[model samples]
Target: MDRMPRWADVILIPLISLILAALLSALVILFIGESPIEAIKLMISGALGSTYGWGYTLYYATNFMFTGLAVSVAFHARMFNIGGEGQALLGGLGVAVVLVYIPWPHWTIALLAATASAAAFGAAWAALPAYLQARRGSHIVITTIMFNFIAAALLNWALVGPMKAPGQEPATVSFPEATNLPTLHDIFGIIGIDWSRAAPANVSLFVAIAACVAVWALIWRTRLGYEIRAFGYSEPAARYAGISPFKIIMVAMLISGGLAGCMAINNVQGEAERLVLNAAEGAGFIGIAVALMGRSHPLGVFLAALLFGFLYQGGAELALWMNIQRELIVVIQALVILFTGALDNMIRMPLEKIFLAARRKSPPPPGPDRKSTSAEAAE
Candidate 1:
C-alpha cells in the first residue's frame, strides 16, 4: 500500500491559522489607538448581544458556509477555483430571472424553480473553464479569474438594463413577496420581539449545514469523489488507474459552481430580501481563504467560515469601539490564509517521520542479494 498524508495532522493546520489570525487582529487594534482587549470585547458583545444578533450572525454564516464548502470541494480535487465569486453572481442572476418571469407561483414551487435555475446557471458558467482544463490544458487559475470578471460585467449590464426593476432607483429587480423566502419569525411563528431589534434568522442556515453533510458524504463515499482524488494525486496515475481526468474536471466544477450558486439563497432570498447586483459581497473569494485555512476538510471549513463570519458580523462594532478601519478584517483573513498555507507541510512533520520509520522496518524487494556474483568471480 502507498503512503498518504495523515488525516489528523491535516486537521491541525487551520487551528494554528486561526490563533495567528486572532493575534494579528489584536495587533491591528493596538495600531489604531485602542485597547485590544476592549475591541475584542465589543466584537463578542455585538455579535452575540442577544438572540437577535446571534440569528443575524447565523444568517451571514450560512452564505459563507456554502461558499467555503464549495471551494473546499474543488481543493480536495486538487483544483484551485477562483470563479466562485462569478458563479455565485450568475446564480444570483438566475434567481432574479426566475422571480421576474414566473407568474405568481406558490412559494414552494417558486423555491424549487429558483434553486434549480441557480444551480443550472452556475454549472453552465463554470463549464467553459472545466472544458478548457480538460481538453486544452488551461490553468484553472487563469480561466476562472477571467471568467469572474466576465460574470461580474455581464451581471452588472443585465441589472442596469434588461433585468432592471421598472421605475426603481436600485440596480435590481425585487422578487415578488410571495416568491421571497420566509423569515424565521414569519415561518416559525414564534414572534413578539421588537421588529427593529429582531431580524429574521434566515432558514438558509439549515440549508448550509445540510450542504456540509452532503459534501462529507460525497468526498468520503462516492465514486466521483474517488476519481477526483485520483486525479488530484497525479493525472498520469489517474489515467493508468482508468479514471478520466476530463470527466473529473466536469464533475468537480459542476458541484463547485452549483454550491456557489446555492450560497446566494442565503442572501438574495434570505438576507437581503431583494435581488441585488453585489449580493455575493466577496463571500466567494473569501471562501478560498477559508478553504485554505481549513486545509480543505469539510468540518474544518465549516468552523473556519463561522470564525470569519464572526469577524464580519462584528466588524462595525469593533471599528467604532477600537477606532480601526473595518477593512482590518480582510487583512486578518489574508493572514490566516498565508499562515495556513505556509504551515501545511510543517504540520505534517510528525506523521512524515512515523511513516518513514515504518517503511524502514518493512521488508525489501522480492529478490536475492547481489553479493553472490562478486563472490563467485573471486573464487
Candidate 2:
C-alpha cells in the first residue's frame, strides 16, 4: 500500500520543500541586512507585475520546460542523462546551420526545419553515451558529464574556425528576416490584445506547451511508455518479460536528447536569431532540479520550470534594486535545488511515516457482512 495518498505525495512534499527553502533564503537575505519581505515584493513586481516581465519569465520557462522534459524522459528509462547542456549546444549549431544554409520562404517552414535539425543533432550527441552505457556498462552520468565538456570544446572550435561569422566575434551571422519567428506580442495583436512591451518570448512558448502535452500523452498513454517505465522500475523484471534494455536505453536517451535540443528553437531561433556561445546557460543543470521537483512528470516539470523562471527573473530584479550580489541569487537558487532534490527524502520519509501511522489508526470501512447484520437484527 502507498504510505500516503498520491495527491499528498505529489504536491504536498514538494510544497513543503519549497517553503523550507524559502525560509532559509529569507534568513540569508536578512543576514545581508536586507528585508526579505521587501526583496520578495520587488521580485514579484519585477517578474510578474507587467506583461513584459511575464514575457521574460515565460521565455526562461520555455527553456526549462524543454530541458526538464529531457531529464524526465531519461528518468523514465532509469537513465541519468546530464548532457542536456551539450545536447542543447549542438542543437543550436544545427539550427544555425539550417537557417543559414537553407533559404526558407516562410517562418513556419524555417521553424519546422530548425526543430528537426536541432532534434537530430541533440539525439546524435546523446547516442554515443547511451550506447556506451548500454553495451559497456559505462555510467551514464559520467559519460554525459564528459560529453558536455567535449561539446563545449567542439562548439568553440566550430564557432571560431569554420562556422564563425566574418568578424572578431565567435558567433554566426544573424538569420534572415524570413526565418525570424513572431513574438507573443505579434500573436496577441492579431487577437486585439496589447502586450505592453517587447520581449524575447516568442511562438516557442506555444511549442513548449505542446511539447508538455505530447510528453504527458507519450508517457502515460502508450505501450512504449509502459515498456520504458517497466524497465525503469526493474531491469531484471523487464528482461524477464523479454524487454530489451539496450533498445529502451537508446530510445529513452534519444528522446531526452531531442527534447533538450528543442530548447534551441526558443533561445536561438526565436530569441537570439543567431547561434551564440554559452546559450544553454546552465539550464541543463537546472533541468535536473526541475525534474526532481516535478517528480519527472510532464505536468510537474511544467510547474517547476515556471517557478524557476520566476526565480531567474525575480533574482535579476532583486540584484538590480536591492543591491544583492549575483552570487547571492545563485545561493538562493542552490538552496531551492538542494532542498527539493538532495534533501527530498528528509521531507518525504517523515511524511510517509506520518501518513502510514494515521492510516493504521483510522477506523476501517464497515464491511458488507450479512452475518453481522442478521445477528444485530436478532438481538
Candidate 3:
C-alpha cells in the first residue's frame, strides 16, 4: 500500500514549527531592542525557577490545555471552531448560575454540579453553529465568530445588569462556599508543601491530562474516531464510505465546545469568580493557534499548550524584569502562530519522502489470486 506515513508527517511538522517560532520570536525581540537571551533566561527563571512560579505555570497550562483540546477536537472533524471563547464563557456562566441558584450544602455535590452545568452550557452554545452548518449549510467560521461576539455582549449585560454582586465594585457576584473547588490542601497534606498558597490555577490541570489521554484513546482505538479522521482527511471520501458528515460535525463541535466548558469550571467556578464583562480575555482566539501548532493531535496539543503556557507565564516575568509592555508576549505569540501555520508543508516533504522510500523497499503481502493459486497447486 502506497499510503503516506502518518507518523512521519505528524512528528516533524510541530518540531519545525517550534524551532521556527523560537527563531522568529527571537528576531522580533532583538528588533525591539531587547536581548532575547536575557529575556528568555528571565522568563524561564520566573516560570519554572521556583515552586511558586511552577504553580502559576501549572495554572496557565490548565487554561491552554482546555482551550487547545477544544479547538483540536473540532479540527479532527475538519471543522475550524473559533467559538472556544464564547463556549467557555457560557460554560462559566452556567457554573456561576448553578452555584448561585442551586442551594447544595454538600461540598462535593455542589462542585460536581457546577462543573457539569458548565459543560452542558458549552454544548448548547456550540450547538447553534453546528445546527446551522449541519442543517442549513452556513459557513461555520463566519457564524461561530458572530456567536462569539454575541456571547461576549450578553455576558457583559448579564454581569452588569442582572448578576451583579450586591454592593460589590466588580462586575461579578460571589459564589457560595460549597461551589468552590477544593484545593490540594483540602484533599492531601504534602510534607513541606502549602497547597493553600497555590494560585487559582486549579486541580483541573490533572483533569485536562486525563481528558487528553481519553481523547487519544478515543481517536486511535474507536470506530467513531475513525470516522472523524476520515472526515478530516477527506469529507467526500468519508461521506462516500457511508459516514454522515453532518452527524460527525455536530459531535465534533459538541466535544470541542464541551472542553471549553470544562475550562469554565477550572477558571471561574469557585469563590471570587464572576463574569467580569465581555470577551473571553483572548483565551478562545489563542486556542486556534494552539490547535494549529499541535496538528490537532492530543499529544501534540498537550505539548503545544505547555509551550504556550510557558510563553504566557515567562513573558509576564520578562515584562516585569525589563520594565516593558506586557504586550511583548503577544508579539512572540503571534510569531508562533505564523511559524506554526507554515509547518503543514515545511516539515512534511522530507519526512514523507523518507518514509515513502522505506515503505517501497518492503515487499508487499501475497495477493488473493497468488495465495489461491499457490494453495491449489500445492494441494
Candidate 4:
C-alpha cells in the first residue's frame, strides 16, 4: 500500500508547494522594496479581472498545454525530450510552408493541413535523435539540446533565404486571408457574447484541449501505453516481458515531438498569421516546469498550464503598471518552478509523515463478521 493517498499525492502536495513558493516570493518582493501583497492583487486582477485578461491568459495557456503534454509523453517512457524548442521551430516552418505555398478554399481545411504538416515536421526532426539514443546509446538530452541550436540555424537560413518575405524582415509573408483562423472574440460574438477583439486567443484553444484528451487516452488506455510504462519501469524486466525498447523510444519521441509541433497552430497560424523568428517565445522550455509540476498527468498539466499562463499575463501587467523589471518577473516565475519542481520533496515528505501518523492514530475498522467490543456495544 502507498504511504499517502492518491489525492494527497496529486493535489495536497502541489498546493502546499505553491503556498510555500508564494511566501518566498513575498519575501523577495519585500527585499526589493515593493509590496508583495499589492503585487499579488495586481496579478490577480490583471490576469483574471476581465474578459480581456482571460483571453490573453488562455492564449498563453494553450501554448503551454501542447508543450507540457509533449514533455509528459516523453517522460512516461523515461526520456527527457528537451528538443521541444527545435521541434516547435520546425513545426512553424511546416506551417509557413503549407500556408504560404498552397491556396486553400477555407479556414477549416487549411487548419487541418497545417496541423498535419506541423506534426510531421516536428516528428521528422525528432526521429534522428530517437534513432541515436535507441541504437547508438547516445544520450537523448545532449542530442536534443544540440538539435535546438541546429534547428535555430536551419530556420535562420530558411527565413533569410527561400522563405523570406519580399522585405528585410526574416519572416514569411502573411498567410492568405482565406486561411485566417477565427479568434475567440469572433466565435463568442456568434453566440451573442461580447469578447475582446484584440485578444489573440482563438479556435486553436479547442484543439489544445482535444490534444490533452487524446494524450490521456493514449497514455493510460492503450496497449502501447502499457508497453511504454513497462519499459520505463525496468528495461530488463520489459525485455523479459517481450517489449521492444527501440520501438517504444521511437514511438514516444515521435508523439512527443508531434505534440510540441502542434503548438505552432496556435501561435503561428492562429495569432501571428505568419512564421516569425523566435516564434515559439520560450514556451518549449516552460513546458518542462509544467510537466514536472503536473506530475506528467494531463489533468495536472491543464491546471499547471493555467497557473503559468496567469503568471505570464500577470507579469506583463506588473511590468506595465507597477514599474517592476522584467527580470523580477522572471525571478518570481523561477521561484514557482523551483518550489513546484525542484523542491517537491520538501512538501511531499512532511505530508507523507503527517498522513502516516494520522493513519496510525486512527482506530482500526471493525470486521464484518467480528462482534463489537463491549465499549462500542454500550455506546
Which candidate has the top score in TM-score?
Answer: 2
Model 2: lDDT to the true structure: 0.87
What is the C-alpha lDDT profile of model 3 across 1-379, one tens digit per residue?
3334334345565677677778877887888788888988998998888766766777777777888889888877878898999998898788778877778887678767876888898888999999999999999899989989889888878877888777755366667665567654544444555654565556567778988888777776789987887887788999999999889989989988988877776677632455566425677777877777777777777887888888888978887888556787677667667766644555556667876677679864555122212111110
lDDT of 2 at 109: 95
Model 3 TM-score relative to the real fold:
0.86
Stretches off by above 4 angstroms in model 3 are 1-8, 168-170, 184-188, 191-198, 270-272, 347-379
Q: After superposition, how far is residue 50 of candidate 1 from its true place, in Å?
A: 1.4
* lDDT tens digits, residue span 1-379, model 2: 4456656767898889889978888898999899999989998999999988888889999999999999989988878889999999999999999999999999999999999999999999999999999999999999999999999999999888888899888999999999999998999989998985577889999899999999888877888887888888889999999999999999999999999999999999998999878878888878887887788888889999999888888988887898686466567667767887678789889998988788789864565233312111111
Cα RMSDs, all models: 8.8, 7.0, 6.8, 6.5
* Candidate 2 residue spans exceeding 4 A from truth: 364-379
TM-score of each: 0.86, 0.94, 0.86, 0.93
- Tens digits of per-residue lDDT for model 1, 26-66: 88678767888877788888877766666666776777787
Give me candidate 2's TM-score against the actual structure: 0.94
Q: Which regions in candidate 1 have their CA more than 4 angstroms from the true location? A: 1-8, 167-170, 187-197, 346-379
- Tell me which residue pairs clash in candidate 2: none
